[model samples]
Target: MELILALAIGVLFSSGIWLILRPRSFQVITGFMLLSYAVNLFIFITGKIHINKAPLTLDGVPVDPTRYADPLPQGLVLTAIVIGFATTALYLVVLLGSRGLTGTDHVDGKERDHDE
Candidate 1:
């Protein structure tokens, strides 16, 4: 499970980097979003994967809370997700304004000639 998670993060990070290098403004925004998601996953995994472990004890049962996964990372990831969404929305607005002003979606505010 941990290996799979690691590979997933790597894939997301790689894809994000690739997209970031693209010439399109929208692709860059999407790359940022994907990078943020990768970071969130990393943060969440720092708390460790608890299989079949209950975070809260039931009926006053004696279970070590420390045995359960830490909740701090979970909270952090949740907050990051919200912030990422807001930033993505803002980025889209900026992208639209840029496209409108430049009449192009390229990051440099202009489209290149097909020959180039």
Candidate 2:
């Protein structure tokens, strides 16, 4: 499970970096989302995984460290997910607005022909 998480983190990081280098606003936005996902996954793995663990408390049950995972990371991930969604929506609006105003979507602005 640890190995799988590590591999997933690596893949996410690599893909995020690659997407970020693209010369497009949308790609950059996607890269940010991917990086956020990688961070969330990394944080989640830090708490360790347990089989058939219940997230809520149960009556007449002692606190079992081996059976229960930490809730802090899960809470953080939830917050991050909400924030990510808002940011993505904002970015999409900004992208559309910029394109509507400038008639281009290139990260560095519109390309010019040397002959012009």
Candidate 3:
């Protein structure tokens, strides 16, 4: 399980770096997504993984909380997921507006300037 998590982290990191290096704004968005996923995974792995563990208290039974996985990471990941979605949506809107107004998506605005 740990190996799988490690492999996933590596792949996500590589993908994020690759997308971030691209000149396109859309690729940069993808890179951000990948990086966020990698970060969430790393945070989760720090807490360690457990199997067949109960999430909460049971009737008349004292359970060892350490034997179960931490719920904090899951909540954090959910929050991150929502925030990432919002960020991606906002980025797309800005990219589209930029392209529509300037007639180019490039950051340097060379395509629009050439038209003048």
All candidates: TM-score = 0.87, 0.86, 0.80
Shift in Å, residue 11, candidate 1:
0.2
| Model 2 bad stretches (over 4 Å) | 112-116
Residues 1-116, candidate 3, lDDT per residue (tens digit)? 99999999999999999998876777888898899899888877676676776556677877777766777777777888888789888988888887788777675444554453
**lDDT of each residue in 48-113, candidate 1, tens digit only:** 987876655577677777767677888899999999999899989999999999999999888887
Clash counts per candidate, in order, are 0, 0, 0
Residue lDDT tens for model 2, 1-116: 78888999999999999999987888988898889899888877666776677666678998776677687778888898888889888988988888888888877667555524
lDDT of model number 3: 0.80
Question: Please, what is the whole-model Cα lDDT of each candidate in the order they appear?
Answer: 0.90, 0.82, 0.80
Among residues 3 or more apart in sequence or in different chains, the pairs in candidate 2 whose N, CA or C atoms overlap within 3 Å are none
TM value for model 3: 0.80
Residue 35 local lDDT, model 3: 91
**Residue 77 displacement (Å), model 2:** 0.6
lDDT score for residue 88 of model 2: 83
RMSD in order of candidates: 2.0, 2.5, 3.4
Strongest candidate by lDDT: 1
